[model samples]
Target: MESTSLQPASAPAGKFLSRFLIITVTICILISPGYIFFSERGGIGFIEGVTVKQLLHLIFPFFGLYAFTLVWGQIIIGTCKPLIKKIFPGIGRFHRLEGIFAFIFALIHPVLLIGSLGAVTYLKYEFVGPNKKIFVLLGVTALLLLIVTVTTALLMRLPWLQKRWKKLHYANYAVFILVFIHSWNLGTDIQGSPLQYLWMFFAVSAGLGTLYRIWRAIVKRRTAMSAQSATASEPTNSLNPPNS
Candidate 1:
C-alpha cells in the first residue's frame, strides 16, 4: 500500500489579513452581548438627542484594534522558545510587525476618539477624555507601556541592542496590567451597567487566573522534582549508613 503523503502548506500573501479578519470577527462575536446590552439601555446609548454616543460608538472599533494587538502580542511572545535559539532567528521581524500593529492602534485610537468626546472635553483633557480621567491615565500608561514594548521590539531589530532588548521587553507584564485596567474599567461604560462591570471584572480576572494557573503548575512541578531528588538521595544515605 502507498503511504499517505502529507500536504505541504505554503504561506499566502493574504494570510495575515485573513487571520486578522477571523480574529476580529471572533472578538466582535464574543463581545456582542456587551454591545447589545449597551445599546438598549446600558451604556451611553440610551441618552436621547445625544450625538456623542453615536460618535463614540464609531470610535469603538479602535478598541477592538488595540485589543487585537494585545492578544496577539501575548501569543507571539509567550509561545516561542527562549530567544537564544538559532532555529527561529528572525525574532526582530516578528517584533517589528507587532510594533507596527501596536503603533497603528496607538495612532488610530486617539484620532478616531478625539471627536467623540466633543469640543470642550477633548480640548481640556486630551487624547482619552475628562470624565474618564482614571481611564485616561490607564490609557496613557498603556501607551507608555507600548512605547517601551515597541522600543524593545524595534531594538530587537538591531544586533547592537539585542542583548538588552529581552530584558526591556519584560516590561510587557506591567503594560498588560495597564491595558487591562484601561479596557475593563474605562469611563462610564462600567459605571452605567452592573452586568457590564461584572463582565469586565471577569475578563480581567481571567488574565490573572491564567497567570495563577501557570504559577501553580510550575510550583507543583518543582515540588515533585524536589521530592524525587530527596527520595533518590535517601537510598545513598541508607547504603552509606553514616554514624550520627
Candidate 2:
C-alpha cells in the first residue's frame, strides 16, 4: 500500500537545478538592500558628511522594501501551489521562517523611521489637518494587523485555537492592501525611482494571486456541491424490489 503521510515528500531526481535557482534568488534578495543603499548614496562616496542618524533614516526604506517582498512572496506561494510545488518542493519547510523574517523586517522599518522622526512625531495622526499624515496612519494600521495575524498564527499550536486562527490570519490580505497604498503615497525610495516599477510589479502580482485564490475556491465549492447533489439523487439499494 502507498503511504499516506502528510509530510512533504522529498524532491524527485533532476530537481537540483530548481533548488539551485531558488537558493540563488534568495541570496540575491538578501543582499539587494546593501546594493541599493550604496547605489543611492552616490556609489559608495556618501560616507563623507553622513551622520549616524542619516544612515538609519536611509536604511528604513530598504527594510520596508524587503518586508514587502517577503509578504508578496507569501501571497504567491499561497496562491500558486502547483508552481511552488514544481519549482521548490521543500519550500513548505521555510514558510514560517519567511513570515517571521518578514515581520522582523517590517517591525524594524518603522522603528528606524521613529528613530529619525522621534516617537512623538511618528505616532501623530491627523486626518483633516494641514499636517495630515494619513499615509503614516495607514502604514501603522497595516503593521498592527500584521502583529495580530502573526500572534494568532503562533498561537495556533494550541488545540483550542487551531481551527480559529485561520480566520484571523486572513487579515494579512488587508494588511497587504493597506501597506501598498501606504507605500505608494509615502515611500521615498519608490516614488520616482526604478524601484517604483518593482513595487508596482509586486502589487499587480499579489492582486492576481488573490483573484486566482478566489476563483479556485469558487470552483472547488461548486464541484463539491455538484457531487453532493448527484449523490443525493442516486437510487437507494433495497433488499426487496418495488412494484412497477
Candidate 3:
C-alpha cells in the first residue's frame, strides 16, 4: 500500500519538475536578448540613440546566440542520453521543437542584418571589412550548413531518405565548429564580457559531448562485433558438441 501510494506521488512530482524545467528554459531563451542588450549597452538609455535599422542589426547577435544555444543543447542531449533521462526527463519530446526554433532564429539573424545593411550592400558581402572577412565567412558558411541540415531533417521521414538523413545530420558538428569560430572572433558582446566565459563553457561542453558520442559509437560497434562473433561460434560449437 505504501509503495503504491508513493508511486503515484512520485509520478506527479516528476511531471511537475519536467514542466518547471521546460518553463525555465523557455523563459531564459526569450529573455536572453534583453539581457544581452542591457548588459552590453548599459541599459535602456542606449536604445534611444539607435535607429530602428541599427536596433535590428544589434539584435542579430542575440538571435545567433540563441540558435547556437539550442544547437549546443541538442548536441549535449543527443550524446548524453543518460544525463537527460536523469535530469531533464521529458525534454527529448521537445527536441524537434527546439530544432525548429533554432533554425528560425538562425535564419532571422542574417535576415535582420541584410535588412539593416540593405540588399545591395549585403549582396556585395564586403561590409564585414577585410580584417573580419574570414570570421564573417565562417558565420555565413555555418548558416548555409544549418539550412541544409535542417532541411534534410525535415525530409527524413521519407522512405528513401530515412537512412541517408542521419549522415547529413552530422553536418551539424561542422556547423557548431564554424559558428564557434565566427562568434569568438566577431561577436561584440562575447568579447571582454562575462558572456565570453559562458560561451567558452558551452564550447568545452560540446567538445566533451562529441568525445562521449565517439566513444559510445566505438563501444557499440565493438559490442556488435563481439556478439556476432559469439553467435557465429555458437553454430560451430553446436555442430561439434562439447566434451560435456
Candidate 4:
C-alpha cells in the first residue's frame, strides 16, 4: 500500500530546520531558570561577584530542568500521538531522541553539581545531612530510574524485547514526578522565580496528557469486555432443529 503521509524527503531542509527549532526551544527553556536567577544578581560583577561554584549552584537546576522537560515531552508525545497522528504523523519519532537528550542533560546536571560541591561533601550532604536528606534521596532515586528508562529505550528495537519495552517505559513518568518534587522543594532557584511558573506549566500539561491516556485505555478495555460478553451470550446455531 502506498503511503499518503507527508515524508521528510519532500522537504529535507525544512525538516532539518524544524528539528533545529525544537532543539533551540528546548535549550531556551532549560536555560531560562538559571539565566533569570543570574540576571537578578543586580550590580554585582558577573564573574567576580559570584564564584564559579556559586554560579554552578545556580545553574545546575537549569540543566536538570532541561532533562526533566525532555522526559515530560516524551510522555506527552507518547500519550497524544495516536490522537494527533493525522496532523503530525512523525511527531512520535522524536520520543527516542528526547530520551537520549534527557539522559545526556541528566548526566550533566549531577556532574556539574558534584563538581561544584566536592564528591565527599556532596555525598555526605545528600546522604546524611539533617535537613536536605529526603530531597536528595528523591533526586538520586529519580536519577537511577532515569537510567533504567534510557536503557530500555535504547534496547526497545530488539525483536525479543519489543513487546515489554512500553511497560518499562512507564518509569519515565515516575522519574518525572520525583524530579519535580526534588526541584520544587530543594531548588532555591525554582522556589520564588518565574521559573516556578514554567515548571507548573509543564507539570499541568504532562498531567493532562497522562490523564487522557489513562482514560482512553480504560474505555478501550471496557469496549473489549462488552464485545466479548455479547459474543459469548449469543445463541448458537444447531444442526438439528427442535420440532420445527
Candidate 5:
C-alpha cells in the first residue's frame, strides 16, 4: 500500500508559495519595459511614432537587467537555501525556474538588439574594436557561457547526467561577473540615471554573496581536514601511548 505519510500538509502550501514567487517575478519582468519607457521618455524615444524595432532596441537593457536579477535571485536562493527552507520550505523549486527565465531574457536581449540593427552592423559593433570592444566582447562571452550553462541545466533531468549538474552550474558565477562588467561599462541607460547606482548596489551584493560562499567553503574544508587529522592522530596515539 502506497502511504501518503511521506508528504505533509505544508507541502501544498510550499508549492503554492513557490508558484506565487515565480509568477511575481514574471510580472516584474513584463512590467519593466513600460516602466523604463516612461521613465526615460526622450532618452528611450517613447514620445510617438516609435517603430517595433526601435522599441525593442530601447527595451533591450531592461531585459538584460531583468535577466541578471533573475540569476542573482537564483544565487541568493541557493546560497541561503537552508535559511530559505526554514522560512519557505518549497522555495527551492523556484531556483530552476529563475535560471530558465534568466536564459530566456538573456537570449531575447541580443535577438532584439540584432533585429534593431542588422546582424552585420551588430556584429561589427560587438566584435570590431574601436574602443568599447572589450565590453562587447565580455557580453558575447557571457552570453555564450549562459547558453552552455542553461543547456547543461536542461540536460540535468536525464538520470545519467544528474551527478555533473553541480559542476556545470558553477559557470553561473563566471557568467555573473562577465555580465556585470559588460553592463556596468557599456550600459547607456544606467549612465547618469538612478539605475546606475542600483546596478552598482546589485553588483556589490552579488560580489559579497560570492565571497561569503567561498569563505564558507574554505572554512568547511579546513574543519573537515582538522577533524580527519584528529581522528588519524587518535588511532596513532592509541598504538603508542604517552608515558604517564
Candidate 6:
C-alpha cells in the first residue's frame, strides 16, 4: 500500500542533482539575455556623457558582482534541492524557500540599478534622464512580486493566502517581460548591436519552455483524471459486466 504523500522511491528520478541542474539551467537561460546584453554597454554607456571605456570601467564591476550573485541563485535553486530538503524536511516549505531566494535577488537587482543611476545623476548633469518615475514603478512591481512570492511560501503560516501568493508569483512572468521591454526602450546601446537578437533568442526560449511546462502539466492532469475514472468504473462494470 502506498501513502498519498510519500511515494515509492522508484516513482521517478527525483534526485537532488537532477532537479538542481534543470532549475539552474533554466534560470541561467532566463537571465542570460538580460545579463549578456546589458553587460556590454559598460559604465560610460550607462552614464550620460562618459566615454564608452569610462562607463565600462565604472559599470562592469557592479554588473559582474551582481551577475555572480545571480548565477549563485540559479545554482542554489536548480542544483541544491537535496540540501534544501535536508534543511527544511518537507517539499512545500523547501519549494517556498526557492521562491524566497528568488524574491531576495529580484529585490536587490533593482535597488542596485536605481542606486547606481542615482549616484551617477548626482555626480553629473550631462543629460536629463527619462522618467525615473515610470522606471521605478515597473521596478517596484517586480520587487513586489518577489515580496509576495516569498510571503506565500508560508503555506502553514497563511493557508488562505496560498492561492493568492501563487497567482501573484505568476506575475513574475509579466515582470520579466516588462523589464526587458523597459530595457529595450531605454537601452540606447542595443540600437546597433547583436545583443538585441541574442536577448530575443533567450527570451523566446524561456517563454517557450514555460509554455511547454504548462502543456505538460495539463496533460498530466487529464491523464490522472482518466486513470481515476477507469479505476472507479472497474467495480461497477464487474458486478454486471458490460456486454461485448
lDDT top scorer:
3
| 14-69 per-residue lDDT for model 6 (tens digits) | 66555577568767755664565456655234678765545544553334233323
TM-scores for all candidates? 0.50, 0.80, 0.84, 0.76, 0.76, 0.53
How many Å off is the CA of 144 in candidate 1?
1.9
CA lDDT of 59 in candidate 1?
Answer: 50
Q: Candidate 2 vs candidate 6: which has greater lDDT? A: 2
Winner of 3 and 4 under TM-score: 3
lDDT of candidate model 4 versus the reference: 0.78
Q: State model 3's lDDT.
A: 0.81
- Backbone collision tally, model 5: 0
Q: Indicate the residue-level lDDT of 148 in model 4.
A: 85
Candidate 1 Cα deviation (angstroms), residue 227: 18
TM-score of model 2 (CA atoms): 0.80
Q: So what's the TM-score on candidate 1?
A: 0.50
lDDT of 1 at 18: 55
Q: Name the weakest run of 10 consecutive residues (lDDT summed) in model 1.
A: 1-10
Winner by lDDT between candidate 4 and candidate 1: 4
| Candidate 1 clashing pairs, residues 3+ apart or interchain | none
Model 6 clash count equals: 7
**lDDT, residue 36, model 5:** 60
Error of 6 at 228 (Å): 3.0
Q: Taking the tens digit of each residue's C-alpha lDDT, what string does model 2 give over 1-244? A: 2464422343433467677887797687556655765677677566567787787776788788888778877777777766678876777656667878879999999898788777776666422254437777888898999898878777888998899888887888888888888887777667777667777877888889989988998999999999998787665634348889
Candidate with the greatest TM-score versus the true structure: 3
Candidate 1 C-alpha lDDT tens digits along 150-188: 777765768877788767866666666666566666534
